[model samples]
Target chain A: DTAVSQTPKYLVTQMGNDKSIKCEQNLGHDTMYWYKQDSKKFLKIMFSYNNKELIINETVPNRFSPKSPDKAHLNLHINSLELGDSAVYFCASSRGVRSYEQYFGPGTRLTVT
Target chain B: AQSVTQPDIHITVSEGASLELRCNYSYGATPYLFWYVQSPGQGLQLLLKYFSGDTLVQGIKGFEAEFKRSQSSFNLRKPSVHWSDAAEYFCAVGPGSDMRFGAGTRLTVKP
Candidate 1:
């Protein structure tokens, strides 16, 4: 079984368009996270949710919003996507807010033209 | 604030050769360290982690890492590397809500 999974593995959209990526975990984890990997392969945390509560929001632009409908799911919605948004986005989950290990999903590659 | 540094951007090794990937971290309090591997076109997989027990931690696929508090380092090693071992390795530090990851080191295995 895939502990963590992401939908829409590849997203290609035009500039100014909007898109959303979905993530789900079956590990019964309470914490979920979104990360961005730039072309240079620098991975940075974008947002984190614990028990459906927002816990960490890095200095990401307001255009990007993360929503957690339930503890098992977290989705990212990007508005006005720009060329700079072209990169890989990863979704991860952990047992709790202080859990040491995180399980990651096969990232979604976004291309903004 | 916590940060991780993986000085080696890329490394190449022949099959059956031994391997070591360096990782250094900076944090104020006692840190939780982890090593994750990402194969090409795949997601990140936790190789091992160091919470508070023994300094040496064993992971899947014949991988191990030693956490040295004096040096603030957690280096991953393998006695003999296989071609399937080639991948991007990341070091992370955290015990809270936020985990900091290194830029990552890409391993290229030669046949």
Candidate 2:
């Protein structure tokens, strides 16, 4: 069983299209996060959810939104996708807010044409 | 602001040779340190973490890290490197909110 899993490991879409990446964590973690890794492999946190509540929101564009249905799921929805949004999106989860050990999924390689 | 620096962007070592990856962090307090390895086309795997107590912590896959408080460094070490050890290594340090990761060091294996 995967601890943290993201659907559609690879996404290919045209610009201006709207797409969503789903994520689920089997581990009973209270904190989940979304991270974006650019082509250069520079990973940065986009958003974080603690117990289904928005906690950390990095300086990201408004086009990207994160929704956590429950403590085990944190999905990312992108509106009006841009070429710059073509990157590997990763979903991660930790035991709690204070926990530093984060388990990441395989990652979703999104390609915007 | 907290930050992590991995000076060497890349490193090459022959099989069975010793390996060490340097990591330096800038933080106001005693930061939580971690070392992760990412294989090609895969997610990051936690090698080890140093929260408190022991300065030298052992991890899975025969990896270890030494936490030096004065130098603000947590360098990863392996006595004998394997060919499969060639991967991207990252160093991170943080707590409370988020962990800041280094640029990552790509390790290559030489025959």
Candidate 3:
């Protein structure tokens, strides 16, 4: 079984459209994270949630929102997606905020036309 | 600001050749270093991590990294690389609860 899983490995839509990517971790971890990889393969943290509570939030635009319904699930929803929003989004989980090991799921590549 | 630097953007070597990937990090406190491998269409897999103690850390798939606190460098090396080792490698430094990743170095292995 996959330690972390993501729905819709690829997402394609037009600019100004809204979309969502779902992620789940079977590792029973308490901390989850979201990262965005740009075209240059530069990965950066967008948000971190611990036990369904938001802990870290980067300078990401308000158009991008992260929702964690539970500790195992964290979803990314983009409103009025722009061309610059196209990138690979990754979901990761760790045993705790202080834990060293982090498990990442297969990324979801989002394309905005 | 905490940051991670990967010196080489791309590296090429023949199969069975020695491989080394350079990484440098800037953090205010003790640097928690990690190396991750990203294969095509797959998630990032941790190769190794250095929290403290021995500077030399061995990782899965026959990979190893040495952390140098003086130079602020954590370099990943392999005695002999396999064709399957061709992928993107990332160096990350964790400060507090947030981890920062480098731009990544793409490895090309020749047969």
Candidate 4:
């Protein structure tokens, strides 16, 4: 069984279109995070939710928004998608805010054309 | 702000050869350290983590790392590396809400 899983392992969309990537975790963790891996392979944190409450948020574009229905799910939505939006997005979860280990999902490869 | 640095962008080693990947960090206080591995098209997997005690921490896949507060380094080492070990390795520092990762070192195994 997958601890953390993201749907649409590959997403391809045209510029200016809107898209969303869904993420879920079965680890029964309280904290979840969203990360973007650029072409250079640099992993940057975009947002984090602890017990469905927004916690860590980096300097991401306004077009991107994260919604967590509960502790098990955190979805990412992008409005007015641009070419720069192409990258691999990862979802992760930990037992708590300062847990030692965080589990990661396979990641969704989002490509904007 | 906290930051991590992996000096070598890439490293190559032969099967059964010893391997060491250097990682340095800049944090204000004592830090929680971790080493993660990511294969092609895969997510990050925690190889090991250091919270407290035990300077030398052992991890899966025959990997181990030493935590040195003096040099602010947490270098991953393996006496013998296998071909399957070829992948990207990342060093992260954080016990708090914010965990920062280094640029990562890509390992290539030679035949």
> What is candidate 1's TM-score for chain A?
0.98
Q: What does fnat come to for each candidate?
A: 0.77, 0.52, 0.57, 0.52
Which one wins on DockQ? 1
Worst 10 residues of 2 chain A by lDDT: A92-101
lDDT of 2 by residue, B1-111 (tens): 789999999999999999999999998888899999999999999999999998999999999999999999999999999999999999998773588889999999998
Give the TM-score of chain A, superposed on the true chain A, for all candidates in the order listed: 0.98, 0.98, 0.98, 0.97
Name the better of 1 and 4 by DockQ. 1
Note the B-chain TM-score for every model: 0.98, 0.98, 0.97, 0.97
- Residue ranges of candidate 3 with Cα displaced over 4 Å: none
**lDDT at position B36, candidate 4:** 98
What is every candidate's C-alpha DockQ against the true complex, given to 2 decimals?
0.79, 0.68, 0.66, 0.68
Query: Any residue pairs clashing in model 3, and if so which?
Result: none
Q: Score residue A77 of candidate 4 by CA lDDT.
A: 96
Model 4 Cα lDDT, one tens digit per residue, A23-100: 999989999999999998898989989999999999999899999998899999999999999999999988888835
TM-score, chain B, predicted structure 4: 0.97
**Reference-based TM-score, model 2:** 0.98
Tens-place lDDT per residue, model 3, B19-78, is 999999999888888999999878899999998899999999999999998999999999
* lDDT comparison, 1 vs 4, better candidate: 1
Writing each residue's lDDT as its tens digit, candidate 2 over A8-65 gives: 9999999999999999999998999999998877789899899999999999999999
Docking class of 4: medium
* Candidate 1 residue-wise lDDT, A56-99, digit = tens: 99999999999999999999999999999999999999988884
